[model samples]
Target: MRKSKLMVFIISVVVMSLLMVWDMPKVFDNINLGLDLQGGFEIVYEVSPLDGKSEIPEMSAVSKSISKRIDVLGVNEPSIMIEGENRIRVQLAGVQDQDQARRILSSTANMSFRDVNDNLLMDATVIKEGGATLAFQNGIPVVSLKIADQDKFYEVTKELATRGEGKNLIVTWLDFEEGVDSYAKEMEKVAKGEEPAYVSAASVREGINGDAVISGNFTDESARELADLINSGSLPVKMNELYSNVVSAELGEGAYEKTMIAGIIGYIAVVIFMIAMYRLPGVISAFMLFIYLWAVLKVYNLMGGVFTLPGIAALVMGAGMTVDANVITFERIKDELYKGRSVKKAFEEGSQMAFSSIFDSQFTTLIAALVMYWLGTGSVKGFATMLMITIVGTLLITVQVVKFLLGLLVSSGWLDNKKTWFGVSAKHLPDVAKGEERKYFGKFHNVDFMAIFKKVSLLPVAILVIAVAMGVFNSVSGNGFLNLGIDFASGTKITVQSDAPLTVDAIEDKFEEFGYQVSRVQLSGDNNEMASVSIKEVIETEDMYELKEALEAEYGYEPSDSVVTPVVGRELVRNALMACAVAWVAMLAYISFRFKFDYAISCIITLMHDVLLILAIYAIFRIEVESTLVAVVLSIIGYSINSSIVTFDRVREILDGKENAKNPKEYYKTVVNEALRNTGERSLITTITTALPLIALIFLGSPSITGFNTSMLVGILAGAFSSLFLAAPIWYTFRVNKKPTQKKQKNVKKLDEPTEINVPGINS
Candidate 1:
């Protein structure tokens, strides 16, 4: 049986290895990269009625129209999303003709027929779907349209026929600019020796209405384009560009390469740390960690998901979480070995004992990820997706596979006397045969946590208060509490890259020469050859094109630009708040259902403390707060809850032995203090593992995500502090002060009988 177990372990490892080698490369190649990765353009349009008083068209119809236009552009997998009630966001990745794409996207295509008096006679409502086709008439290319309403066309022709021969001209106009284009205006322009705005004009002879031909001074290409545009259907409402982001392919490639390097560095550091700390079990964990990462990316590829910059960050964060679960189980196994259990028995009991905490942590984090996915949009949704995939992957691969491999190794009877292999020393072991009690195993085991909680608790509160005061003062002084990024502040950010080194003053001078004021300039890239300049004003489309041309002339290549309007900025703020609030409420409900109300309260308070501390740091340090801050806060909420739940689980376990003790309040203190002591190392280790990727990202990753990584690093440190010092103490305050009910007393007495405590584990 032992041989079979060993063989099965070997086979599993071999299978995982084979699968990774065969499909991992394919997964990387097939995964769709978002606009932020590949070079492309994204724009948000505010939809409004053509006339001032008409009701806005349905969002579905508008998106369908936009989708049709994108089809003409030949863009692969364009993303069109409706934001709020009146905005549509279109993302086209890897589009080459960005200028033409933007022009085609915003074109109204509102074809019209008017008489010499500039009176409207017919409109695009007569054209059938896909009815327009390019054709030849008398060796001249023209657009042919199958009119949906033949009777209306006949009436219009009959009315025009009543006018005099030379004056009875039916003028056809394409994209009739409201308040701008008219027959009189065109005639005036014609008289001034300029081109007319109308496409074509025809004299009405009879009321023939089966089909209509729009003949113009057209080449084959122009005629084909006009036919395609007509077939695509005119947008029911006018669209105003409110936000846009255009990235250069070179910048995207640089970002992807740098971020991947950072992630690899972080992953390696985490693996080395785990092996150094846990010995053999750490080796198994590191192996499973590789499998875990493969499974996540492979699954993402299978799902046909788009990979983005934030998605990469999510993957790095998942590595941290994967290591965290392993550390918890390994720590538990070491604790079991210290109690004089055999290697096999310690492996079994530790796996069982660690199950509840790991499950609780995973479950709570799942809640936060789900909330983020439900309420998030754009790249935020992408981050949430990667996070969810990692969580699911950890449960299926990290938790189960690691435990199985380690179980097989221990049960083979080859390491029966090798407890040191599991990282337990002879000096720390207690002999069960001699009736020596097992002392706590952590370095902090001898420290009195409750004795210092009173003082340490004050420090966070004081810091939070000062942070709030600073926020108020900053707000009152006309600057926002936190340094808002372009994502939240609604501005234009231009990224200019040069082969030679560039400075802020040089970039500022260039902008000044262009007659535009620069708000701020940040330098990045290895040699500081790239500069990101922010402008408070949203540059118009024509002006942006001119600026891009000028910068390209000055620099070597055209730069990337992102512009956001005030409307989208406001919407982002609202959605971010909603995402955070929904996450907190959802977590509170989940914890309350799994544990108790008081425990739920304590966990939530600690989570709030973590967020406040992170915000405080950002506000005090003037870190630019962007839309990704929502992601950071939500992620920290998940991380902090994991720690809080683990500690609470320990408190519950220790309290199981307190049924017969007098002075229950003092016992509560001991239970809480002991819980902190027991879980302190796990908390610290989790933070370190999680922070590894973030620190690497801050120093070595893409500048696009540097602020995001920095914010996450601060939140992680704050989460660890709250988990160890604040969470359980708050719970202790609630528990020690509450009076026990008769029913609760009965339950406690029922648990008094010595029976097997069924620890929820894989074996169970």
Candidate 2:
């Protein structure tokens, strides 16, 4: 090995290590955590015009109002997005009280000042937006209000000041709803289920301008809470909370640590495997992998994406993909060396030839992810975002940067001494030829893909058949078509954190003792100290309130909860189904545009097969199909189409070579055969290499995203199998009878004489 190349590599490693320790963490800390990873509630509220109005209110003004409210609430990081024309989505991370948050967000805190005679003097229109704060007056607590309109406020105060000293007083009231400002009316409202709180009243001995501080009977906490709510500004329209969820801190922290561990372990395993497989090229791949991770995280920080548990799963998935790209490039290099090319020539041409397949594969996945991001919401959006970033980053770091660095080593003469460092044995090189070509990489590659395809295709079909029966059974068993999670189904779920570990039986017993039937029970957090207990029936808000109080008081358990109303539940299910379809069709269109129509048609069929088979598995197992399920299904589609695209790209390259040849060797069958042989190793290598990190996530990562990881795993394996055997064979069946033009033999070398090249289904 050349000392220069070795030193360069050593220096790069040291610099990356230093950057990882000192810079990456600092950059990553800038990444925001989602509600599921921090403790808080995410709610989507539908705003409506007043009861007598017929038109919808403007959403931009509503969003601004809610944003100011969240800022005043002192939330760590709150996100407010306007949907369509009149809906608002608010996500508050690290806020504990869900009930209080809902009240504060939806309540119209209409501040009013009335004279002591119970006559209204001024309304909230005169106050500046976000101009309320808790101040001190004469060493006592007071609520301060800033007036935006000096003339209006002064006119009101001047009238009040002219009254006798005993009657000249301004009383402040924060109305929870409209039309109630007096103490009597507020008391009457309080007699019902709701009430407006009285803030403070002050003497208006003189006209005031700019700001007014009212000192009264007030405590520090109450004064501050009222000030914050008042500063939030009143909503112009009524906000009805439609969907909401609160995540517990214990669960969030546990998921955080477990996912990080899964990432580190999975990454280390991938590094070890790469070095074992590709030697020096593997080391270069590892460096590029490091850089890829660093770059993606930095970009994520810059994009201001909120990191969720599912997003962590996406990042792990991304790492596996980076490994896949590295594997593809290195495998091509090995193929070149096996054909007797020198190290430098192999590296050069191999990277060049590998680009087409990689581009097609990555491009298909990117298209699907884009569709997912566009249609998905909340954490699903976050996952799709990371998926896109990962794909782009893989193309940059794994493909472009790895090749550049490996070329440096090759050019510096570090790789000139032996083929072992490049994972190519001396016997495989052409110079040692005992002549007649052999299987690729010392592995048997002469399987009859068409024949095997006909036989093996039935497995997924059979799985689909079973899946169909299972789905029918599930549908008939009073459970709709799938065991849907609360995210897509109507129910009340309470996630509880106790000082002690919770067992299913114990949880069931507790609910049973309380005369509440537990529909489902799941455990999370370290040592199983947390449990999510759900009830399928629609429990009243009052009942849920009593239950929460009882559980908290008696068991000292802190429970975060979610409720999906029937209307929203129906909408979720419909949208998720629609998203799955849209993702499939979008991929088909992109593939069709990029390649030929036949390849696109066959790829979508195999893609559908993969999706149906996964659904069948979920049905048989009664897995919950929730919002994240949509993300998982799309990711699988992405992966399935990706594998199919790789095979087709190879087929196209070969067909083009055949057409340009002076003499075409055989025709479509031979072309298809060679294409499959060339790509089968690349397919298998990618599948196995990508599965490494997922395996870690399945075992050691957050339990929440285990479904997503498992789905991707199944799809990847199925994709690799179908891409090599099914997709190509099916496409070949479409064009099997087409005749090729006669031409002279060109330089393209076919693999060693096949035991049997032509099969029954292909140009028999």
Cα error, candidate 1, residue 30 (Å): 1.9
Winner by lDDT:
1
lDDT of 2 by residue, 473-517 (tens): 867877767777666667888887777777899888877776887
Q: For each candidate, give its TM-score against the true structure.
A: 0.87, 0.87
Please give, for residues 1-764, the per-residue lDDT of candidate 1 as tens digits: 88988899899989989998898888878878887667688889989988765798789999999999998888887889887789899989887455677778998888889888778888888888888898999899999989999999998898788888867898988777667777887888889988788988889887866998998889998788888887787888888988777766555666777887998898788889888888899889988888898899988988878888668767867877788888889998898888788888888888898888888888888878887788877766777889899988888889999988888888888678788888777778887788987864778888778778887988887887887788889999988877777767768978898999899999999999878878778666677787778887778999999999999998897787777666666676577668778887988898889788889899988888898888888877777776677768767777788888899989888876455347866878888878888888888888988888788888988886677788888888898888988898899899877777655444344565688667678436
TM-score of 2: 0.87
Q: For model 2, what is the alpha-carbon lDDT of residue 230?
A: 79
Predicted model with the maximum TM-score: 1
Task: Write down the lDDT that model 1 would get.
Answer: 0.82
Worst 10 residues of 2 by lDDT: 657-666
RMSD versus native structure for model 1: 6.9
